[model samples]
Target: MRIVVPIKDNSGLESEVCEHFGRARYFVFIDVEDGKVKGSEVIEVPFKEHEPGDLPAFIKEHGGEVVLAYGMGRRAIAYFNTMGIEAITGASGRVKDLVEALLKGALKVDPEWRSKGDFGRHEF
Candidate 1:
């Protein structure tokens, strides 16, 4: 499976998972099979700014099957869902650890996640 993780830096597997999915500076593309990681590639966010569907479209173009992020707004998650990509929000820690947890089925998805101010914002 191909997983996309929004990150703060280019540390590869050690990269810190960015708190906000839409505003992340970098992204790590990981390929896993048989419960083991096969390879990974990192890329910078393509645009200076983005709208609701851009990131999800980008992920689809790259053949991503899953998204791992600490937090994401409802619209973004909906977009991913529309594209047939699984958005696993409320994820944290290093990219490697998250991948391991995914393979182990240890990550949780909180359907009611929301920011402090309103349901419109994304707060990690």
Candidate 2:
């Protein structure tokens, strides 16, 4: 499976995960098999400016099956859902660790947790 994790830096598996999906600076795209990371690549989010619809399209273009983000707005989340792409939010910590946990069925995503305040900032 192809999984995409928002990353703050591209140093290694220990790099911090980014908070926002659309505005994330970089995304660590991993190819998993048998619950292990077989291959991976860091793709830079084209620019800082992006709309809710653009996110899903970008994921689709990159052949992403799942998105691991710190926090995603309702519109963006809905867009991913519409595109049949799983959006996992409230994620923090290392990008590779998150992917590993997800592949191992250790990570549980709470899709119901919605931001009530400003949509851009990090809350969890």
Candidate 3:
């Protein structure tokens, strides 16, 4: 499975998950198979400016099967869903750790915790 996580930097597996999905500086792509992470890569968000639905398509283009992030607006999540990508929000901590927890079926996402707003500024 290919899991994409919005991160704050280019630290690979050690990268901290970004608070806001659309505004994240980098995205970590984790490849997992047999319940183990095969490898990962970090890349910068490609566009200088984007609209509400752009990032989801970008993720899809890059073959993202799931999006693990701290916060993401409803519209973006809907877009991801339409594209068949699972948008798992309310995630935090190190990128690798989150992936591990997810694989272990321990990652919990509170559906009630919707992102406060959009355009890269989300309330906690």
Candidate 4:
């Protein structure tokens, strides 16, 4: 399976995960199989600035099966769901640590947060 994690830097996955999905500078795509990291790469977001849907579509093109983000807007979350890709938000800590937690089933997605709209700004 392929998982994408929004990262602040590509420094061996030890840096903190990005807090905002739309504003993340890079996304580290990791390929895993049987709870093991097979391969990975950092995909740069094009155009310096992008809409949420655009990033999701870029992820789709890269064979992403899941997304591990810190926080994301409701519209982007809905778009990911419509694409049948799993999105786990409200994540923090290092990218590699989060990935390990997910592989070990130690991480839990907060559905309440995911279902909320507009990062608590507007209603969906």
Candidate 5:
């Protein structure tokens, strides 16, 4: 399986997961087979600032089947789903630990913060 995780640096599995998906400094793509990691690659977002739906499109082009993010808005989640890619939020940790937990089915999804109440949904 190919999983895309947005992180703060180029530290490979040691990179800290970024707090916002689209705002992450780098995207680490990890490949897993038989419950073990095969390898990982990094994607640096282009120099141009992001626009709506840009990152999602970039992820789709990179063979990403799933996304592990800190917190994402409902629209972004739905956008990924439409592309047949799964989005899991409320994830935070070093890249390796989070990947292990995900492979073990141990990452929890907090529904209260998922839909309309996440980091980007504020209208104030």
Candidate 6:
């Protein structure tokens, strides 16, 4: 499975999870096999300006099956579900540690604070 994690920096696995998914500086795509991470890649969020569903669509286009985020709104979650992607929110800590927790089935999807789903234009 391919898991896409939103991060604050391009510090490889040591990168901390960003607070916002749509505005993260970088996105890490981790390839997992038998619950073990086989490989990974990081890329900048494609658009400096985000539309309602652009971020999720970009992740899906890059073969993401799941998304790990710190916070997401109802609309974003619904969009991800519609695209057959799982959105796991309220995440933090190093990316690798998060992945390890996931492998052990310990990375629980923390509850998200309700959002108005109103994000103004953001830059990369």
Clashes of 1: 0
List model 2 lDDT by residue over 10-107, tens digit each.
75466777766655677788888877889888887775676558767887899999888877777878888988898888877887678778877798
After superposition, candidate 6 runs with Cα above 4 Å error: 112-124
Q: Please give, for residues 1-124, the per-residue lDDT of candidate 5 as tens digits.
A: 8999989888878898877786776899999999999999998876447666677889999999999988776677888989999998888888999999899988765555454334663221
lDDT of 4 by residue, 14-117 (tens): 66777777777778999999899988888777657665588789889989999998778878889899998898987878888889999999986555654543
Regions of candidate 5 where Cα sits further than 4 Å from its true position: 109-118, 121-124
Q: How many residue pairs clash in each candidate?
A: 0, 0, 0, 0, 0, 0
Instruction: Give one digit per residue, the lDDT tens place, for model 3 in 1-124.
Output: 9999999889989989887897886898999999999988888888767787888888888889999997787789889989999999888898888999999999976554564545344322
The global C-alpha lDDT for each of the candidates, from Candidate 1 onward, is 0.83, 0.75, 0.84, 0.79, 0.82, 0.82
Q: TM-score of model 5 relative to the true fold?
A: 0.86
Between candidates 4 and 5, which one is better according to TM-score?
Answer: 5
Note the residue pairs that clash in candidate 3.
none
Give the total clashing residue pairs for model 5: 0
TM-score of each: 0.88, 0.84, 0.89, 0.84, 0.86, 0.88
lDDT of prediction 3: 0.84
Sort by TM-score, best first: 3, 6, 1, 5, 4, 2
Score candidate 4 by lDDT.
0.79
User: What lDDT is obtained when candidate 6 is compared to the true structure?
Assistant: 0.82
Per TM-score, the best of the predicted structures is 3
Model 6 is weakest, by summed lDDT over 10 consecutive residues, at 112-121
Worst 10 residues of 5 by lDDT: 115-124
Give the candidate number with the greatest lDDT.
3
